[model samples]
Target chain A: MFSRDRWQEIFQTIGKNKLRTFLSGFTVALGIFIFTVLYGMGNGLKNSFNEFFMGEATNTFSINPGRTSEPYKGFKKGRAIEFRNDDIDDIKKDFALYLDEITPVISFSATARYRGESNSYSINAIAPPYGDMQKTIIMKGRYVNAHDMAGFAKNIVIGRLVEVDLFGHSESAVGKYLDVGGVMYRVVGVFQDDDGDNEERMIYMPYTTRQMLDQGTDKINEIMLTYNTDIGYAGAMAFDLSLQKYLKAKHNIAPDDQNAIYLRNMADIVQRNMMFANILQLVVVFVGIGTLIAGVIGISNIMVFVVKERTKELGIRKALGATPASVIGLVLQESIFITTIAGYVGLVLGMGILSLMGDRFKEDYFISNPGVGLNIVIMATLILVFFGVLAGYVPARKAANVKPIVALRDE
Target chain B: MIVIKDLHKSYRMGTNSLHVLKGLNLSVEEGELVAIMGSSGSGKSTLLNILGMLDEADSGEYILDGVPIRNLNETKAAKYRNKFLGFIFQSFNLINYKTAIENVALPLYYQRVNRNERQEKAMKYLEKVGLKNWAHHLPSELSGGQKQRVAIARAMAAEPKVLLADELTGALDSKTSYEIMDLIQEINDEGKTILVVTHEPDIAQMCKRIIHLKDGVIVEDSFVEQVRASSYVQ
Candidate 1:
């Protein structure tokens, strides 16, 4: 019956103390805002990475050679061993059934020139199957073929940045002459990468040409491989270990050799970044929870004080046939009223800030667009109600305990 | 009807015990209009507190509407008080933020009274206290007399078995006090039990019975009341 009046009183009190209430709410809002932004960033980072790693040779492995270590059947202390082209053939032929595609690469940085424009660049000498091995999106032109690779043709492919620099934004850079290290090569293809800068400073040439060009280099710089199925993650991992062991034994190398060749799977980068994001999100939630707790406690303390002020009124109500439940309800309504209004204000402000931020900023490393979906809002709402009830507990009990006589006597 | 036996109450301020009531015994029957008079520290207010269940009797028994209250817990005590008690204080004790109708509607909040019904009843009671014209006026806007009238209407709203008033006219001018006294007496005549405490003999004399206490013990009980006729008796 009196619940209406209780709520009315709650709102009235809040309306009376607008500044204090807003401050408390602001703390809570800040907590939620931090958590929401962190989580959104985590998601945004995930989105960015997903965009970056658009499915190519996802679970793949490679093997590189190392230096001689211990006495591997009478090897010298500093004897360096390496894999020849034939050794690569041996591995590929032996693992042909399991192999998706393997492309050996050899390269070095040099200047790329078109007409009068010459820009410093890295030469990426890849096998004809390197396009499939690179597993990246092509923006223009066609990829080189096995025949072109076997014949060691001067055909070339470039990244969008390189294409822009070499051909001045011309889309049909294919078949055009691009001078790499003063040698003319025909542009065959172009690619678009998320980090255009990383790609623009590179030139792709036939692996055979690059290998022959480096007279001192008997082995390729790297090998990239892909698998057709993902169930082979474990198999792929084991194979990678075995391949490393094979290379070590045949090349007679030590495990700790600084110059030892090693594999770097892009999947590992993605996994590590994701883990970083998750940990970041956890930290954000802890901060948010801390803020919520502070706000809730403030609300509780203020509610207790409010109840104390209303002691005589409660007494009078009790004496006038108000049940303890009613008294409790009255105080509870006040607490919930304050919390609901305050929390809602906080939520709106938090979400509003996030929305505004989202509108203003593009996805970046530390921040993403602000978002408060149903889940976050609903959770905050529940927290507000719970905080309200907890805050109201003592006050409600005090009101219920008021002896009509003593309450009336209270000043 | 109400019965209190051997009611003892004390407040602990640090280690010192301030005895407010010591083995006080009192009784008020149905439809009785009574006043308990005492000076400061005479425990008149304490007696009122114990009677209203705003404080507990250290070791005592009290019965209201046939139910013994010594065994009641804090919450139960409040329920008992709410079920059968109504209180009016010298300060009027009206929630200052509430409009007259809302003030009158307060006690009913605990009663789980439906909203429409409670509003209707509050309006009805406000009219009875002659504050219907200012139903929306908050206590601050009302004169002391008007505030007390609103308080009186609030006390009457729950239809409690007993109305307890402490220094009901202490803050009011003579004319307003007399008017409030008349209203209270009229309410009592309507068959509601009331127990009022005051130091003013004139105020006590308004009741059908007066109990005077000094030092927490009743010194006198009387049936003789200073009779004052109201021009608008109804």
Candidate 2:
């Protein structure tokens, strides 16, 4: 296949018509470039979305209280609804077998101070299961436990950023006392979240201790829950709906009052996101194929002109005892050579640009690392070869069918 | 080496059919240097085409080297054309893009000879035509006489049984024409059968025999006192 004479002939022919060859090759290269970039960008966008939901559980949902939209019994429609500790205890006791983890949360912004250095941070009071549910990484010490909550101890888990704020990085903040909201609390643990300092600006403590610190109010802000959902989307939604009804009954809200109890189904959002990603992938493939077809058409058009130009030469070859297959092979080989080389060049350039852009946009969730996989590269190579063959076929056939006598007489 | 019996050919121009070759019967034995001569539209070109196997007769028997050349497929016909017949055209129809040596090597390429062997054979033939020094030059770079010599070298490289020349000097001056004829005569002296198709009486007189055609029939077929092409001053 790498015969020197054949290669010389191909190069000579291509060299004679430099502009035509370059234009045709450029179209194929452009098509491949667009294909690689579009598909890579599509996957990158989907990856960014997945990154947002990575640390938190996919099967988890949260419940938050809202203003009653519909009255029940003697309750007014505009009445503000709020959750209590008793509701959290009842839900945990009743759904303990079905639930994976459940936690009650109450948060408020407060100042953390150790000696002279002080910085404002959000204070989160949660149960022991909160750390495991939110995938929080404990840097030192332990989180608030059942014993701490039962005894209503003033123990707090400071975020890693809060630790740095209250005490310098050289000192350990755990086992030290920090003043939070004018109350002294011992730091039980130092932890971090996936988003680095963004999540590390908050601190955690026992919910019971927070309630006592807040002047004897038993009101809880929200309840976070996760359940086993191997039974799929419909079954999970059915369980969620039943749990919503149970919450409605406990809160004395009217049945079918949708605004009274706000529920966020993270599992449903994950499923919807996966569906959108699949559709995006299909769209990229379709557009890529369309561009490839246009490139192939451009190649065929140029090949027709080339075949016409070589009519006399082909006739001379045929008279010299060249077989039809040999004549056809000449044309096909040129097309394949041009397309494969140009397509490879385009692939490399497109991927290189994407890699640079990915680094530039690293801080944004809209686009992540945009690049093609090995399978896509392999598939693109095959498609380029196929396009080469398709583009060369008609002109090659015309050259093969040329009669030596007629062609020789042609001016 | 070549035989034709009752050969007929025609052309169709829309509604009109022009019968070119009426009932031609001829044969040329081995080692014969023959020339077919006639005026324009006398069907000599058609006869040359049929004899070269570039075209088929409507109804006739054409044989070469004891093999009946009738109804052979394109592949078989091309094979026989390569092995038995070599053609030199009036315009010195060498591929313009190829260098002189590459043009000479082309037939050998189709014969599936390896690259080294083809190059060696092509160089030897170029030397025979006395154009060895100009081999690497393209056809465009060579003069009319040099181009014809390159075409002759290309034809001889295949080592075919019969060499066919169609007005081989029609595009050259009288001096260059005779010089080309001198080269053709030298090739024929080596015992290769050759057919020269021309309209010039002086050119036909240079051959050992002349067959004159008129209205698609042979009017004369006779041996002559040959005038050697080299005897003409260049």
Candidate 3:
């Protein structure tokens, strides 16, 4: 039976200030819109790079000893650096923590033959841990074992295309012998590459055997090394200067060589991804929180104007048995009521806008189907209530403090 | 009942102070219909406001219901007014936004009366004042006399000990003025103390006693027989 005519009066006041309320809601909606979109896009970009790099050798560093801008060993600025097996041995000795397994890759095209099938394919002479350094995703069977390298085992793993072109299936290639340059080598393992294709062309042989049989003792094109530790940054930094200096001394080159073996730091990609993630989160927070702050300030400013306008009516109420606390309660309730309604309006619009974009936000790297989360909505609602309380505080206090006699006597 | 002793009120503009009431002393017992007759700026409205607790005297002893209230704060004063006082303004100061019944119920609403009960009480008072047909009509829709009638209903609904009417029918013509005076006299006869501010001796003649003021001081206080031209307002 209680008449909340006071609350109805407050509703009427807010209804009269339509544009002010609209602008406040718009600020909150815009904030939520930007936050959802940016987070989705940032995650999407991150996932794309992850997809491209996922199955590749994350632990191994390829040695490219060529192409220089500054002279090494007093050679011309643009010079190609070269290395042999002895240099690889010296590097392994210097940083034992850095070198897990050293695989010497020797590749060349050759005519391979079996009993009824004959095809031309590329051949690779590899050490025992060569498959791990190649970044090949092994789908079936084992890689070359230590015994295969020590006994000079006539075992080869062919590329995907070679298996298809010769036997038409990777499973059939295993346990069969294929003549590599007319030297019959049995298949030790059938493997698939990261791209979902069989890697059958690499006719792997022992490095010692490849040297003894093929007369390639002086030629090892690349030293493929995997770190014993997964702490990439420490391994990379520790190896950079020491490896360059060791190479300079071993090759009898200048100490500060502009052209040394090319080292790729995989940690750079990880660090960039991490930093971008933080930036994306910050951008979302700023845009979203900024909108909420603007809304609160707008409501607060308009409340000040409203209090000023209704001074006379409030004075009359004061003279009519209304307590200071009751006066404050009236204004505060009105403010909270107005902001809550407006915030809900904004929340609905913001969520709707984000959902409309969710279907189109497809990308490979990050979580693409982003929508306004309930936790964020709840947080926004709490903020609005706090905003209402804060915005109404000063005006309500002023109203409560009014002296009734002076208030009523006002013209 | 209202009583005042050595009451003083002044208005300051720049360095000059204009004394509105100077050393005034008077008393009105319950059931008394007292008309305060004074010209414009003779401080009749000022005295009325002070008695109603709507303004403070610079120096005075104002005792209403045997309690001193000269220095009471706004909250206490509002409480005092709500419990014991009602007012009828010359301009019929009913809130324009409120219906006649709502206007009548304003005091009860402040006192936390139940909604339906407050409406019922408000309508009863309005019917007594012959305004029940216009219960939902706003002040803007009513004639000047009808608005005053609504004001009277509001004043009576609260059942106050004293009704202070500041120029109660000042804006009405002669006939409406007498009708309002008759209502006030009827209320006084029923044991409510009524004090009216007026410039016309004709209005003053309707009351049991008259207090005449000039230059903010009481010039005379005596009972009047009747106005020679007296007739029913209808």
Residue range A359-379, candidate 1, lDDT tens digits: 345543434444646587658
TM-score of each: 0.79, 0.90, 0.69
- Candidate 3: chain B TM-score equals 0.94
lDDT against the true structure, each candidate: 0.72, 0.86, 0.72
Q: Write the per-residue lDDT of candidate 3 for residues A298-336, one digit (tens) a residue.
A: 666767766765566676566555667767777777666
Top TM-score: which candidate number? 2
What is the fnat value (0 to 1) for candidate 2? 0.51
Reference contacts recovered by each candidate, as fractions?
Answer: 0.71, 0.51, 0.35
Instruction: Write model 1 residue lDDT over B1-234, tens digit each, in one string.
Output: 888888888889899988778777888899998989878889887777777776667888888889887766766775676578777878887776668998888778667687889899999999998988999998889999999999899888888888988888999987778888889888988999998888888788788898888887788888974566353234
Q: Model 1, residue A138: what's the lDDT?
A: 76
Worst lDDT run of 10 residues, candidate 3 chain A, spans A27-36
**Tens digits of per-residue lDDT for model 3 on B1-234?**
678999999999799999999999999888888899988889988888788787889997999889888677756777787788887877776766678998888788777787888899999999988899999887899999899999899888878888888788889998888887777776776898989888887888888899999999999999777453236754
Candidate 1 C-alpha error for residue A77, in Å: 8.3
Judge candidate 1 at residue A16 and give its lDDT: 62
Could you tell me the lDDT of residue A56 within candidate 2?
A: 80
For every candidate, the chain B TM-score is 0.93, 0.97, 0.94
| TM-score (C-alpha) between model 1 and the true structure | 0.79
TM-score ranking, high to low: 2, 1, 3
